[model samples]
Target: MVQADACDGDADRMTIREAIREGLREEMQRDEYVMLYGQDERDGESFEVTAGLHDEFGDRRVRNTPISEAAQVGAAVGAAATGLRPVVELSFSDFIGVCFDQIMNQVGKTRYMFGGESEVPLVLRATEGGTLGAAAQHSGTVHTLVSHLPGIKVVAPATPAASKGLIKESVRSDDPVMFFENKAIYGERGEVRTGDRTVPLGEASVERAGDDVTVVATQRLFGEAMAVADDLAGTAELEVIDPRSLYPLDAETILDSVAKTGRLVVADESPMSYGFHAEVMARVIEDGFFSLDAPPQRVGVADTPVPFAPDLEAEVLPSAPDVERAVHRVL
Candidate 1:
């Protein structure tokens, strides 16, 4: 029996928490096979993203597992292969290391190794990024490394609206998807279209338009890029694009934007060394190097562990000014 009601089919503003709750609730109601579990998912999740889901779906559907990352992933994979859709939350992206074996060898390569006999239609949601005083061990934007793995789709949504839509789509997809929620902007509010809303994976959304420089950002930095571009409106026309899905990258959109703009800048929260910004920079170089007027620029976190102090953390992480500087460099 369906416990939680579906979306009301009306557009309304909501926090990221409310939006994600609606998405998980809607998906659970739409498919009886869909189940959600994590550390504290049943008793108001640590981040409160899945708050109250247990009450609506009951204990059998919303479970809280032991703090065993490998066990959680292995169980989710087994359940998915047996005709069940399980959404597992790893709490934080940094904890991905605990289940790397399962994710890399078992879940990631199951379908290919089995000759397409089984599908791991599991959605793993994890809180990502620093800036909340969550120091080194607790914070990470690990999508850069995770995206390198085959058979796993990486998704990072910018706003509440995109969060609701993309998460709903991720739950319904027939492949394993790693969904990262930026922990810093969880309380930010936005308009979310109700009733079966979805933003397809691998599509890039141009947040702002310009003719001189293109700024492509991921995760929470996507909005920061938009704001920085707005600040530079009078000086230079800046176009901001959010490539929501990192793995099946929207290369065409970014390439076209670079072609028209003649310059590119990537702003990401990850470190500069082999980071998410490096991935975007490499893409532009490989496909549209000839279109560039100046050297491509990247704004990313410093190569160091995130500090607990706010001031020290600010020094390492990329900010609006850093993005502005990078944009100026390519211009």
Candidate 2:
């Protein structure tokens, strides 16, 4: 289920940040080759995603880097190319722009460029989405751009369990996985598997099973979809799906759901113009056209820069009302 836990951050519930920390600790313990680096990751990032990791792994593995996104990412690429598996956190998803060349030209093309000679078993962790008032420069749902590029795998988990499972998978992946954590929904918590729970990189989880409409969302929007579905349960039985992995998207699962419901509404936190929402809509139209009863609806961020104010941020970002409207349109 998308809202797997009854409520977020319960007594036993683990926050997404805590789940991620557990994933890192377990991965680091299982494989000494797995090391973590990035700005303030050891001491704790601004989001506290890596807090206390330094003490557990020490300065050797959880080293800090300079404020050079390009240099640090490039160094990680080089390190992974050799033998070690390094995970680099970009801190903010917006910073990926600074290391675009290193990621796209080098990290994405390394194995293919070498004719399948070597693998880039590295993971890039970054905070995504707005609602933190981080301003336009710091906040964004930029995983859409990274997923468009080939060779790099992408995973965006919504709940604590989903985050924990996918993160462990990303750390052990054979290819470079872009793990986008939604900054807006980091504090929410849910049940996490006790040990060795690894969600495969390219799998989609069905949050709710309904026959009326299919609502596919990622990250923060995924939670919105699930909540909206439960609220609208009296009218439309919504089948909400979470595309945990964006690059190697679980297209078959999504297509099958659309076929069953005969209606699809894609929710993407990114802007709508040529955004990731369009990509999922395209897949349904191309692969499940015959099954669709009505034109698909898309819920996405407005085609404008994210506003820094809380009110404006809510206006620009996808919300429960948007998902409900899309579901209504399809119905």
Candidate 3:
């Protein structure tokens, strides 16, 4: 984890929503070309993350778009290709299918198809994950699907600090970037640096350092694993890492931790079948195979769709106890 002293006492306590808004406000102030648009963003009705942005930036740069996801993404692609840096939100990550063609074909492939002469400086922001009774349609963690695409970058920030920093970096990136914010953590609070502080993409934050086992998690699971680490402090020392950028994964940090611990356990809110957990385990085994004392374990939701019922959702989702059990299994 980044220490408070690193900020030189220029940090303020803010929720994930406020942190992201602050980052967007700072970037828009720094670059005149940075513009934000999405459903209900102008009125700050959609998740309230873009609240007050429209008031500050005016309609030109922070206008609301129509309900059509395809039109919003398609327009953002065209705008980016011309000159503007557009940050378009899709309301929910599950709605990605509505504009997958535009994202995969146009946003992800425009630069390569244009012989590297053109740039798509676009950021697609979406709220993801379950546990809010949003059901399967509105509560899917689809970063794994987007990460599979070649040309786009995937980022999932777990904390307020990371959310602010990653948003700034995504707007500044020349390539198309997919920013997946966990809907459940929108109101979670943490201390974020007040000034211009950006956490680079493709980097992992080691929230807790230990030597017995390594536990890699993302989004909500990152916080769960941290709590599990604290509960098992003396019993089993687990090194917890948050892979902020899923596509350009910080495999080196995970590999080094595994090399030291000789055991691995990956936890994610996504399904277990061919998902982020599998990718992390694959990378560790392929690169750090000899550093294993036991078979690595994975903790995630079942292969079924997320249920709307709270009881069923709790049963399907991976919890802190699940992470603790996985650590015990690896040990």
Name the candidate that leads on TM-score: 3
TM-score-based ranking, best first? 3, 2, 1
lDDT of each: 0.86, 0.88, 0.91
lDDT, model 3: 0.91
- Tens digits of per-residue lDDT, candidate 1, 143-175, equal 887788999999988878778988899999888
State the displacement of the C-alpha of residue 140, model 1, in Å, after optimal TM-score superposition. Answer: 1.5
lDDT of 3 by residue, 1-331 (tens): 3322244577899999999889999999999999998988898757888888888989899978889999999999999999999999899898999999998999899999999899999999999899999898988888999999989999999999999999999999999999999989898898897778899999888878899999998999999999999999899898888888998999999999999999999999998999999999999889999999999999998999899999998999888999999998887
TM-score of each: 0.95, 0.96, 0.97
Sequence-dependent TM-score of model 1: 0.95
lDDT per residue (tens digit) for residues 206-244 in model 2: 878899999999888888998998899878899889888
Candidate 1, poorest ten consecutive residues by summed lDDT: 1-10
Residue 29 local lDDT, model 3: 97
Cα deviation of 26 in candidate 2 (Å)? Answer: 0.2
Candidate 3 backbone collisions, by pair = none
In terms of lDDT, the poorest run of 10 residues in model 2 is: 1-10
Give me the runs in candidate 1 sitting further than 4 Å from their true place.
1-10
- What ranges in model 2 sit over 4 Å off? 1-12
